[model samples]
Target: MPVWPFKRSKADIDAKRLLEAVTQTSRQPALFGEGRIPDTLEGRFELMALNASLALIRLREAQGVESLAQAFTDKLFRLWDAGLREDGVGDLVVPKRMRKLAASFYGRLSAYGEALTSPEALATVIARNVFAAEAHAFAPALAAYAARTAETQAGGELDALFTSEGWPAYQG
Candidate 1:
């Protein structure tokens, strides 16, 4: 079993919806008429984290690391909880259920320490180091959560949810 609550189930319809939701929500307004939605810091994090976890799962599997994928997810979820505790915003920032999904993704990525030092991480690295990396990897997932939130609060006006510069900032 995973150290976290990220159950080891095969990807399904829900996962597909979740992934699509992440992409739709993470999209920035068309950049310079390029029709390219800029990947916000949050979005970047989610993509990186998810991709890294996938990579780690592959690597571990190739090396015969038993249940490594499960372990990775568990660590990510644990770290996510820790990050929330350090910031004291678990309840404030995300709902309980969605938080689990986000945390599970985050936990999975965080498990790949060696991968963090690689060029891919370098390409994905933004402002901060470890913290930035972790946050960036979870950006898309967070965006999905935010999209869901916008839906609940304002019927999913995602464009309004994002800032003119691209991503939203904490008012406080």
Candidate 2:
């Protein structure tokens, strides 16, 4: 729960700022240039991956641990796949509306898939929701989703605290 270098809230992360940075960094003759959009799935993943890697480095430093890259990578992928599911047992349930929007974006950008095969693909995944108007507005929810996902996938600890077969269990 260390705050990002930019700000305390995700809103502070500023999609516009991120877009501008990406735009500037990926300009022609730059590594990420040529038909790249910072708002795409692949683009977002790349951003997320970078951020995650940075966070892991910070975490290791704080804990005074030796290279945690492998552990960090393993946990990150698990959290990435679990993706916001607080409950360890179920699929990561994306909101129907968001899912549709994502599908639409993906479909529109499908043609760019080949062009996105670069390292940018990593951040693109993390930044997947960056383009969603609702995302900036609901960043807490998204963070919660990501936190829950990571916790659930990390181990069985949180599971006991959240679920209950109490009273009338849905034994159906």
Candidate 3:
């Protein structure tokens, strides 16, 4: 029998679809409802980082997810690059901007991963990132929402995720 391959073409396709799903979920208007989030570039990036953090963490436990995770991260940065280009950023500046964007994403990922270890920490992170100057009264709801999403994704399969219907509804 042949040895298992390090990369699977099908998995890559599914992962791309999954990345798109996560991206769409992150941009749901409900998340920005009633001034909850600023709905600007920073706000969109923050929400995407949060959703991507949760998805990547959950996806890491699945089989053959290594490449998928990396591809998802790449897709994220590609989106950032495209956005920069659309905003009239010069080619000379794109690389520097991408580096800064990557740093911002990694910083949020580290902070979020650390926070996910405890409810209190998660609340604090959410308050600081999501609410900013406002009170964190919604932290509990947000935490519950994140937990539900993780649980739902954990139970799902890669093929299922390729379909639009596979995505879990945002509970927050």
Residues 52-101 of candidate 1 have per-residue lDDT tens digits of: 34334333433343444444445545544554556556666545744665
**Higher-scoring candidate on TM-score, 1 or 2:** 1
Cα lDDT for residue 163, candidate 2: 26
Worst lDDT run of 10 residues, candidate 1, spans 28-37
Residue lDDT tens for model 2, 1-172: 7666654333222323333332332232221323332454455554354334323323333333233334444444444445435434345354553455345444433412332333343233323444333223223333333343333323433112122211112111
TM-score of candidate 2 on Cα atoms, chains taken together: 0.24
| Per-residue accuracy of model 3 over 1-172 as CA lDDT, tens digit each | 6599565675567667877887888777766756366688778877788888877777666776788788778777888899889989999999999998888778777777777767777777877877774346766566666666666667776555555454566655
Two-way TM-score contest, 1 vs 3, winner: 3
Instruction: Report the C-alpha displacement of residue 9, candidate 3, in angstroms.
Output: 2.3
Overall lDDT per candidate, in order of appearance: 0.40, 0.35, 0.74
Rank order (by lDDT, best first):
3, 1, 2
RMSD for each of the candidates: 18.3, 20.0, 5.1
Best by lDDT: 3
TM-score of each: 0.30, 0.24, 0.80
How many clashing pairs per prediction, in order?
13, 17, 0
Candidate 2 yields a Cα-based lDDT of 0.35
